[model samples]
Target: MTLNTRIEAAIDGALGRATAGSVPPKLAAALYHAVKPGGARIRPTISLSVALACGDDRPALADAAASAIELIHCASLVHDDMPCFDDAAIRRGKPSVHAKYGEALALLAGDSLIVLGFDVLGVAALENPARAGRLVGEMARFTGMPHGICAGQGWESEATIDLATYHRAKTGALFTAATRMGALAAGEDPEPWTELGARIGEAFQVADDLLDALQPEAVTGKPAGQDARLARPSAVTELGVAGAIKRLEDILSGAIASIPACPGEAMLAEMVRATAARLTPAHTATAAE
Candidate 1:
């Protein structure tokens, strides 16, 4: 099956299970709204890519892992757009979940997706118990506290912030999980894959920093100038536009260099390059020469 098709099927099945039964129609609609027509699907795509690169022994398990990662990501976006966080009105060019579904339902939907992510992995355990267990542990570590996205969120509430730590947890953790889990699912050692994911994650954040700084809501499909408005630390804020662009290039280079040996190494490298190209922001036409 095609990669996109595989991903969509996994996500569809998971969401269907959670929101099945017509008892709470609005909630189910809201859940579908939060996930349908997803943005990029980069995290899960990376997960599946790594699995392919490492000899996809258990594609079903990899699909579950990828789906779980994406569900968590979607959940985070739903919460992040709420009033308590970014307060974003638009996402993927549509009204944010809270805007469309109200705060209570949006909150509930996000929570439901988060739990469903693990449920997908748990179902996969029925086939391959050990690998499924490892995948769940990896997802938990990336989604929860101490060293995951939760830690990244916690950093926002602290008096002092460590830029690297915050960036890694907030953004890099899942990408890191993508690589590690992909390898683990493929029956390969996951440690060697960490640096590649970290570099790509860092590159992604830097690119996002640029888009958040320079791109319009029309182009970005979300609110612009968020970093400055929200007082969030950003590479664009720290390094300036040109400097941030340079940093993005550097991170992409490191990510390319960090790919571990595999039968599909060349194809994966090409995918990374293509992804980097997509992530790289074009210089605005109206900006100074």
Candidate 2:
């Protein structure tokens, strides 16, 4: 099957289990809403791509890794858009869970998705215990504590902030998780893949900052100027528009260089370049001058 098809299928089965019969109606629906119409699916795409590059011997395990990574991403977005966080009214250009359902249901939906992420991995364990176990550990590490997206969010609450730490956790952690888990699932040493994930994550973070700074809600499909409004540090705030774009280019260049030696190494590099091109701010016509 194609990469996107594999990803969506895995996600569909996982979400169906979570939202299936005997579940609370609204929250179940909210869970579905939070995950559907997935935007870009970049993290999982990277994970699955790396798996393919590494010779995906076991498609089930690789698909599980991709789906689980995506579930975590959806959970993060649900929490990030809540009133306590970004208070975003729209996500992927539609009403956010909390906006449509309620804060309580949104919170529950997010939490459920987080747990379901591990569940997907657990199911894969029946087929390949060793690799599935490794994937679970990797996802857990990046989903919580000092170096994950949670840490990324925690940094925002600090009296002091480190830009790199903030961006890495807030943005790069999942990308890191994506790369590592994909390798682990493919029965390859995951360590060699970390740099590529980090580079891609950092590039994505910079690109997001640029879009938030330059694009409008109509263009970005989410709130804009949040970094400035929330007093949060960002690439644009640090480097300015042109500087941030230059920084994005530099990071993507490094990302291309960081791909590990694999059968699909050239293909992976091309994907990174495609991602970089996709990441260019839509307002570039105005921002680039």
Candidate 3:
């Protein structure tokens, strides 16, 4: 009934179907563990929110798109926590998939989720062929080589780094997909919504960077100081704590301003403001020190 309830149900249902069948028991179990007790469900919520704000023509399409984005996000996390990358032991307040399932199964489970994400998208596209094609293109660009999140991950190994490029791919790509798919779900042009998604995406990354800098494992539900530990490029690393907070505020304001006029504009604005406020460094200062 409520938006949050609907989104959670859809995500759970999708994850259920994704793990069904004769999946290797080990990997399937790993997949289940990886996606269970989902986090803020922000990506899907943002997608659906944009759709509702635009016009609630196709709630199903919005759900499908949201589920797909979340699947991809979860998959990325599974791989990100592998021994090669962050080598994190915990996520979502529990031992990570790799920790529970072993590296081989964890890798397979992450790959499976990536494929399943596209499968969810395909199902969504079946209902609206034209829009589905557009969504596929958008998602592919977001996940594929050269410019997608994959590229964003690869950037870490490079000698010189571009923080904007890394952030855009690592986080902004999905935000772009969420808003664009939301627009398409409402039978609207996605171009107009792109800037809003980009801003929110950047803001989300900035918040994440800030969290890495200031939040603790108890509040964040993930290992803290990862950015500094991994020496990963981050806004906070480039800009001090206060400067990063200022940048996050600027992005959040820009995101709210980018929404033209829509039925759910006010609600969307509230969500952005609330999220930004929650991520403020001042709120998490205790954790930082």
The prediction achieving the highest TM-score against the true structure is: 2
Superposition TM-score, candidate 3 onto the true structure: 0.93
Select the stronger candidate by lDDT from 1 and 2.
Answer: 2
Q: In angstroms, give how far residue 52 of model 2 lies from its true place.
A: 0.2
Task: List model 1 lDDT by residue over 1-289, tens digit each.
Answer: 9889999999999988997766588889889999998999999889999999999999999999999999999999999899998888899999999999999999999999999999999999999999999999999999999999988988999999989999999999999999898898898999999998899999999888888888889989998898899888999778888788788888888898999989989988988998888887446323312
Q: What C-alpha lDDT do the candidate models reach, one value each?
A: 0.90, 0.92, 0.83
Better candidate number, 2 or 3, judged by TM-score? 2
Between candidates 1 and 2, the one scoring higher on TM-score is 2
Clash counts per candidate, in order, are: 0, 0, 0
In model 1, which range of ten residues has the least summed lDDT? 280-289
Candidate 2 stretches greater than 4 Å from native: none
TM-score of each: 0.97, 0.98, 0.93
- Candidate 1, which segments miss by more than 4 Å at Cα? 283-289
lDDT of 1 at 261: 85
Candidates in order: C-alpha RMSD to true structure? 1.4, 1.0, 1.9
Per-residue CA lDDT of model 2 for 1-289, tens digit only, reads 8889999999999998887778788888999899998999999999999999999999999999999999999999999999988999999999999999999999999999999999999999998999999998999899899799999998877898887888888899999999999999999999999999999999998888888888889888998888889877778888888898889889999988889889999989988988887889456636866
